[model samples]
Target: MNDEILVPLDLSDAIAMIDRQKEQIAALTTENERLRKEIKEIKEKIKLTNEYVDKYHGLGDRSLEDARKVEREIALSQSETQWLNR
Candidate 1:
């Protein structure tokens, strides 16, 4: 045996539901924009780090390991941010 219950929503309830959905969309949009900005910033950091690494490597600098560590951290942060956006 199967039983189903159907509930009807009035005008006010429908309006409220729509309003809630709108608020959720707005919040999500804001979050998406923020994540995009964060990703952009991370990319910039990566570019700068790579440039610094390249410059130092050319000069046979000793802080290469530290720069690599920083690069890895930045990459990890970027991956996390991308996962969050998804």
Candidate 2:
């Protein structure tokens, strides 16, 4: 009957183990919230950068400013008048 012995679990050891696991779970929850906020900020920054690129770098006529311009007067010369000649 010595080989077939029964034992009872100590309640204090089980309570200590549960308390440690609860602390670990609380730490993990706080770390998860921090990571979530960090990801949100990163996504917002990426969105702002994309908006800036689209506003300033997309399909704009930046080369037209380099073309040269000249000022000149246009005149029309008439050698004869139609009513006087007729």
Candidate 3:
């Protein structure tokens, strides 16, 4: 049989415990808000990065003639049906 006796808290102790828990909850709420803001900022940064990459991909020094020549070379290497399928 268990011999330990359980002790109950007085009113003051219970009130103190409640106040401590309230402070903890408030701190957690603030942290949650901060994390949400950080996630939004990260998402924005990712969007900007994707835009920069898309813009960078379009930057080219090739002339129209070079592009046509490359296309002709690719056409020669692969069958017309394969390109059509794509």
Candidate 4:
């Protein structure tokens, strides 16, 4: 089997290659801008979700505190009833 020798590219061919690379760079730049906008939108969504989570946890803490206060009151009332019975 005969092996093919590699030929050197001429100057015009190299310039044409550079022009193609420039076109690809322009296309990639446009794509990059689009991706950046998408990333910014995702970040905003994440921020809103974090704010909602914070609000939900804050309400849960208040609910838990109120429940504990009610439990204490019920215990006090039971103790008073027992004393009256005795």
Compose the digit string of candidate 1's lDDT tens values, residues 1-86.
Answer: 12222233455678899999999999999999997888789779978897878777754546677697887888797799779868
**All candidates: TM-score:** 0.62, 0.55, 0.54, 0.54
- Summarize candidate 2's per-residue lDDT along 1-86 as a digit string, tens digits: 54333222456667879999999999999989976875675566557555655555644564222211100110111112223324
Worst 10 residues of 3 by lDDT: 1-10
Choose the strongest candidate by TM-score.
Answer: 1
Query: What's the lDDT for all of these models?
Result: 0.79, 0.51, 0.62, 0.66
Q: Which sections of candidate 1 miss by over 4 Å?
A: 1-9, 59-63, 66-86
lDDT of 2 at 72: 12
**Top candidate (lDDT):** 1
Task: Tell me the TM-score of model 3.
Answer: 0.54
Q: lDDT tens string, model 4, 15-84? A: 8899999999999999899768756755665565456555555578775665556556656765775586
**Regions of candidate 4 where Cα sits further than 4 Å from its true position:** 1-9, 59-86
Error of 3 at 7 (Å): 10
Q: lDDT by residue for model 3 over 1-86, one digit each (tens)?
A: 13222223455678889999999999999989976875675566557555655555555654444455555654564465346535
lDDT of 1 at 34: 92
